[model samples]
Target: MIGVDTNVLVRYLAQDDEAQSPVASKIIDGFTPDAPGFISQVALVETVWVLTRSYKMTRDAVADTIETLLRARELVVEGAESGYLALASYRATKADFSDALIAHGGRLAGCRETVTFDKGAASAAGMRLLGAD
Candidate 1:
């Protein structure tokens, strides 16, 4: 499987860069289950950040995008089950997808609870509040 970078995914999803979009689409569309494209956990998180922060996509839009990526049969998403859990958290709460992904990763690794100072993460990302009273 070939590893896909965040830029490639951003180009395919955003289609904002005319020069790169076609190439990205070609690569993505050419993948098959026999030789699926690999998307890393890091690339997935960065793609979410780019779509939301730089492209100004809404939270629901970002969640939908993530769902599309996760569901693509030609794409092998690393940490996908945890990624799905993160997507669910992103859709159902105010927690950042990145934070939810981090917490989910911790949970999959057998963490009892992830501790954090961010109230949004604690309340919405399934993490424990480190200091909030």
Candidate 2:
């Protein structure tokens, strides 16, 4: 499988770059289930961050985009099961996608609970609040 990076994904999804979008589309379109484009966890997180923070896409839109990627036959996202778990959490709560991913990754790795100082992460991502009473 060929590795796909955040910029390529962003370009494809955003379609904002005049010169790069078509190139990104061509690369992504060439993938198939037999030889899929591989999206790493870091790339996925960064893509979401850019889509949300940079592009100003709404939460629902970001969720929809992630869902599409998860279901795409031409793509193989790393830690897909964990990604689904995180996606569900992200949809239901106001947690950052990265925070939800961290919580889910911890759970899959047999962590009893993830500890976090961020109150939003602790509350929304199912992490245990550090030093909470």
Candidate 3:
């Protein structure tokens, strides 16, 4: 499998770069299940950040993008189970995708609880409050 960078993925999905989009598409779309492209967790997070912060994609759209990536047979996502759990949490709650991913990753790692100072994460992502009374 070949590793995919965040920029390549963003270029492919966004299709906004006139000079790079076609090339990104050609490489990404050419992948097959037997020779899948691999997306790392860092790249995935960066892609989400760019989609939301830069592209201003709506929550539903971001979710759809992530779901599409997860379901793609020509791609291998790192920590896929955690990604799925995070997606479920993101869809069902007010938690950010990164927070939900952190919580789910902790759970998968056998953490009794993930402690956090962010109330949104604590309440929405099932993380334990670090200093709540």
Candidate 4:
């Protein structure tokens, strides 16, 4: 499987860049389930950040888009089981997608709980608060 970058997904999803969108679309369109494009965890997180922070997409929209990507026949998301767990956490709480992913990955690696300083992560993403009582 060929690895895809976040830029390619952004270009395709945004369709904002005149020159690159078509190129990105062409590459994505060429993908098949038998030889699908691979999206790594890093790219997935970056894509969510860009779609939300940079493009001003709503959190719900970003969640929907990510869920759609995870289900795409022409794409393969790395660590898909953990990714889905993160997605579920994202839906059920106000945690950031990246934070949810971190917690999920930690769980998969046999961590009892992830520790973090971020309040949202600690409260919403199942991480233990690292400071204060």
TM-score of each: 0.95, 0.96, 0.96, 0.95
lDDT scores for all predictions? 0.94, 0.95, 0.94, 0.93
Residue pair clashes in candidate 4 = none
* Residue 17 in model 1: lDDT: 88
RMSD to native for every prediction?
Answer: 1.6, 1.4, 1.3, 1.4
For model 3, how many clashes? 0
Ranking the candidates on lDDT from highest down gives 2, 3, 1, 4
Task: For candidate 1, report its TM-score.
Answer: 0.95
Q: Model 3, 51-112: lDDT tens per residue?
A: 99999998889999999999999999999999999999988998999999999999999999
Candidate 1 lDDT over residue span 15-119, tens digit each: 988799999999998999899999999999999999999999999899999999999999999999999999998999999999999999999999998999998
The parts of candidate 4 lying over 4 Å away from their true place are none
Give candidate 3's whole-model lDDT: 0.94
Indicate whether candidate 2 or candidate 4 has the larger lDDT. Answer: 2
Tens-digit lDDT track of model 4 for 1-133? 8899999999999999999999999999899999899999999999999998999998889999999999999999999888999998888899899999999999999999899989889999989988767
Ordered by TM-score, highest first, the candidates read 2, 3, 4, 1
| C-alpha lDDT of residue 86 in model 3 | 94
Per-prediction tally of clashes: 0, 0, 0, 0
TM for candidate 4 is 0.95
